[model samples]
Target: MENRDVARLLRETARLLELRGENPFRVRAYEQAAEAIEQLDEPVAERVRQGTLTEVPGIGRGLAAQIQELVERGTSEMLERLRQELPPGLPELLTLKGLGPQRVRQLWQTLGIASLDDLEDALRDGRLNQLKGFGPRLHEQLLHALSLRRRYRALRLLAQVLPEAEALRERLRQQPGVIRVELAGAVRRLMEVVDRVELVVAGSAEAVQQVLPQLRQQSGLHGGMLLEGALPDGFPVRVALTTPDAFGTVLWWHTGSEAHCRTFVRTYGAPEPCPEEATIYEQAGLPFIPAELREDRGELEAAAHHALPALIELEDLRGVLHNHSTYSDGRNSLREMAEAACNRGFRYFGTGDHSQSLTIARGLSIAEVRRQQEEIQTLNEQFAARGFRILSGTECDILPDGSLDYPDDVLASFDYVVASVHTRLNMDEKTATERILRALRNPHVTILGHPTGRLLLRREGYPLDWPRIIDACATYRVALELNANPYRLDIDWRRVRDATAAGVPIVINPDAHAIDELDHVRWGVAAARKGWLTPEACLNARDLDELLAWLHQRRQSVQP
Candidate 1:
């Protein structure tokens, strides 16, 4: 198992133990082992393979055995047994933002509330007020948190769902007489989170009937031409069967946004059955609209006028930026990360390891920053012959009062700075906007990192004044970051168009903490495409020399 998976199980085990009122010492041990494993520079699986898991601090012999079992079996018997002993929905309650095991246990024991539904009923009936700390404010917060949890929990990230969808498609493609299988719904649009997996399958009647048995195994509801069900993992799925001649029309019906489909049907009678999707668009007297542009947000009007933009593609990126290394919280060393980036054909790589003030991430001290710069200079010399450059940068913290974590001199030493807010994320909208605006005015800040401070499916992005933030970036000549991490595709894609329209360039950053994470740039590119980003509007799309020239010009423009 990966270290993260291992750590997550250990942590959950600890929480479950706490919820069950188990021995305090045992719970602490699990918690400690989880923390140690999370911070390890190497994979726990490696240690398990080496038979040295017990050598790690806080990992006792018993804990090591459990971890070994977890790695080998993908689960723990003890955890399973414990889960069986508790209310099934109790573990889910722990996922709420402010509800801890202690509070959850209190609710369970005092009010007999085990599930979210039970909790909601209690909240409505005033039974939650019986607890010492369950006041009106806490009750209201729980209601809000519960709503968000339900909304997010129903959806899964694109990265998580796409592979499974593709596998399903391949499985169906193998069916005899199956002609085609095209993804539809949110998956086709590349939405960050998908509510369900929808597919359009064109095949002979016998082949389509064969597919029904597979859906039936999932306990799906099968109608005349539709099969709706969920994967074994409970992700909802639907399959619509069609003949080969009507494949294009069926795909269009499944793929277009509700609004876009409505507009199309109203403007040009219903689309006729055709073999090609492009033909449908042609019949409507409009150019073929890309799937990502089917949001009906002026896309139809734009297509009518032939003013569609050429969206940025994965191949358009010239450099990978805002990455981290072992100098901070990253697993890989500086040289390893740089070599990986160079091998990937990027002309340049920007290292934006966390700066001091974010201790949780092992943010770099000023001395370490200088040491890293020295290493970067040495690597540049070694890479010179290969036409590669390693740009020294920092993901500097934007302090609450609108000042950067580093002094002006320290910040200026780096080739660029990605100022981010790692703390004080609960500020009011006006305060948050002003804080980011102040950071934008800092000459050394080249990019605003993950401007929303959001973690998809977990935490909401702090509120912001988008128009003001976009205007400030345009005014300061600072680029905005589209952090490409699957968990945090912050600076939501919808706002990317706004910033770019205001002349602010969007820099698609992997925000990578390890070498493998550099590939996350593709996800950022997907989100950028949804925003109609173009190569000319993307900062990293520029070649190295052009990028350097722009950086130089930005510095000059901001200078007194």
Candidate 2:
């Protein structure tokens, strides 16, 4: 597991332990581990392998041992024992923001609140507000947090977030001493939103002085704090700074976490946190970890011990597994969409338009599906003539009861099916998860399309235990579709490592209702790469024959 994955698990473990009323120190140990692992200069996997993981100050030998065990085995025996020891759904309680470990302990120990549902029940029955110290205001905030939990969470792209970062990058580009300039941070990481725009420039202050003042002049920041001791464009984004001593350091800091940098203080012995992040990491002795993994989730620990995984990249994608067309809610015809995919250099394109249930949006009927098949056949003919290929496909909906729109016979006609949840999305956890899980078992369903029916700013589709759903996908050989639409990048990029670690392959689908939507694949691609997706972990990265073979194997297994 990578640091982000480990950190997230640690946080969840803390929540579970808190809910079960486990020891406070043990809980704190997990939380502290999360914090320490996030800022390490190298991947922690390397550290455990080298037998020197405990050299990092925050984590003692026990925590380091836990990290080692987790990496070797897919999970920690300690975490599993906790699972057997706690309320079953207790860990999910952590995902509810505004509810800290202390409050969770209170509700679980005193009021028997183990999960979001139980907590909600207590709130609705007027039991939660009655608790000491958690009066009306805290109760109210808890409800708000619960509502947000049922909704989608996103971070905007850095460039889209920080406009000034762009201005500074241009100025740095013009400087002769500057060797390179690029926007880093959430912008480079491809987060949907961001707190700052990171601009990394390579140069001596003498070479960049002329360009530095131009960056500070622009507005909207904590007043050049990011740039204070460093490069000029650096300061005003989030922290301060306008100067960078070297391009490499800028690259490291710009790509790391705001919370993680604080770990460098002289806990036992070390230089004070340096003005530049490079000195801080270098003194500890290591290579830089990417900012995307800095969630206080053990990234630093992983880096300290060398535990980073090979990240996924755009080139890893050899095909387009999911995209829409004029057949359903899409904008272009099947041929047009296929041609678009071919232009982007994909080996195959799956035309996954909506299934029949979405009648209002003109989702395909059986007759219409047959017509689509004919058109796909024609397109395949032309593609062969031109040395390109298109695979017939459908984004079949997993109905409210867990059944796909079409029967196996109808589904059999297609090369692949991108099964998804579309309507009746507000079901409770059990119902939502089981419904999708049942659909995944359908013989024709090659992939589970956007497990969470989210539409970013529009609505949070439904609530389901994603950890459980991810496990189900792996058991069934069903890949989880990463709908790459800018607005609906569902099966979120943040969940990439978890999904991959579970032995599930991700298909980055630009769930394009239109041909232009195909381009938004870059956003999902960035999220995937940042999430540490490897080429093998992404099904779409495989060539057409490989994808077809996978489908054939899955399909035959479903048949008599």
Candidate 3:
């Protein structure tokens, strides 16, 4: 079994247990185990085979045994028994944005609402609001959440699908007759969410035909047609079979926005055999456009003029930003995070613990903030001898009234501030835009965190006139963050070019809560590349001295 599959089963078990009124600690344990498995670099199945499953953090002997059973037998008896006890739709209800286990239980017991449709019916009939905690605001939000859920039902996060797609590509490459495999479509474009995985296989049609049956019978593949396949979970996979000579043409054709392909055809006629993608573009008398830029967004014209910007690379980043530690919701301590960042070749680390409004994250009190600052100062001194720096920062909340959570004096104490909206996310576009603008105007705010508050497929961001937000960031000289967490790659790539064009600097922040999460910067860099940002346009790509100087300059610009 894939680690993701095992993680999903464990998570499902936790949710089912919650629905059954199991002990809170037990539910939390399962949830933690699931998290540990999801973040695991090596497969749980491999660990099980090695008899080292218990060595994984959060996986005790009991959980390790369960994982081994699930991995070896392909099913967990405990999970199946829990499924038998709860209404099947009860698990689906837990997916709604605001519906926690307790709320789901209330709906089930108080109103017999076990499914989304049932909850919607209760809302329509005014029965839902009659419950103790249900209110008009939450009712409306739930409805919106359901709509978003339905709209994005088939889409999977890029992080989830990329690994699966790559694995399938590797398997295809191993097939006897497959010459080469290249990902195409939105997956190639590095879109944040994609509904299907598309690939092009280079080999003769006869060779492809010979290998087709064996390919379909591979593990994890359920149903497949001549050129289409499905995973056990029903994710669609589309493939184009072609000869090695036409590999580039096939890849280019399938890795397209219709407009891009049409423009290519109009400019250069139909695709013909070419050894590589660069050759096809060369034949068309244009520079080779990166796959991420093949979006029909004036890229062809730019390539024709040899004017494409050098996209930002992962190695261009010199520092890590907006990271959390034990001062807040983070699992790692300040020193550990700093050490990890340095080990990863970063010259500096910014500590952005939650500020006083997000109590659930253990937001720092004024006294706590001061203490953290002192700790950072000591660490900086210790690291200074080695030419490394740790910057004291805070992910300060932008309150409902558009004011910051910390007073001016308190905010000034930090080397940088990442102003973000942690609550009141349902505001209208104007209010949301204005609130963010007010925060941007704060001279101390170095970066705007996850500018839209989006959580990938889970919740839609508060609506905003993004063009205006970009203009404001530019005017205020504030850097907009491309939050690197897979769940919240906000300041979405689609809007990244707008920010870059407006001369707004983009900061690729992992927003990491743990040391391992620091690796999310790679995803952030990919998102930036998709948006056509170059190293020159990214704040994090600046060297330590240059970065600190820029921060000092921004602060001084606002001083009297």
Clashes per candidate, residues 3 or more apart or on different chains: 0, 57, 0
What is the TM-score (0 to 1) of candidate 2?
0.64
Candidate 3's C-alpha runs over 4 A off are 1-83, 98-103, 110-112, 117-143, 204-226
Model 2: CA > 4 A from native: 1-159, 162-168, 175-184, 200-239, 242-254, 263-285
Overlapping backbone residue pairs in candidate 3 total 0
Whole-model lDDT values for every prediction: 0.89, 0.71, 0.86
* All candidates in order of lDDT, best leading: 1, 3, 2
lDDT of residue 10 for candidate 3: 89
Best prediction by TM-score: 1
TM-score to native of every candidate shown: 0.93, 0.64, 0.83
Comparing 1 and 3 by lDDT, which wins?
Answer: 1
Ranking by TM-score: 1, 3, 2
Q: Write the per-residue lDDT of candidate 1 for residues 11-114, one digit (tens) a residue.
A: 88998899999999999999889877876778888899899988898898999999998999989999998888889989889888679989999999888899
Tens-digit lDDT string for candidate 3 (1-560): 87768878888888899898999999999988987776565678789889997788888999999989888888799998998878888888888878999999999998899888898888888998779889888999898878887878889988889998888788778877778988998999898889988888875445554544323422211111237656668888777776677677778877877889899899888766775888888888888899988888889999888899999999999999899987887767899999999989899999999999898788999999999989989998899877789998999999998899999999999999999998988789999989988888888888999988989888888899888888988888899999999889988888888998899999999999888899998788878888999999999999999998999888888774
- Tens-digit lDDT track of model 2 for 1-560: 77667767777677767766678888888887876665454567888889887887768888888888877885888789888987776666765645666777777778888888898889889987667887887788678877765543333434245456677688778888776667776665567656455665555445555765444323323212244233343333432233444444445445545555445332314334234555656676755656566555566777777876677777777877678776775646677778888888887887887888887557899999999889888878878966678888888888888998998889889988888877776688899888888887776778888778776654566788888888888877888888777667777777888988899989898877666777777777767766777788889888777877888887777664
The Cα error of candidate 1 at residue 250, in Å, is 1.8
lDDT of 3: 0.86
Model 3 worst lDDT window (10 residues): 217-226
Name every residue pair that clashes in candidate 1. Answer: none
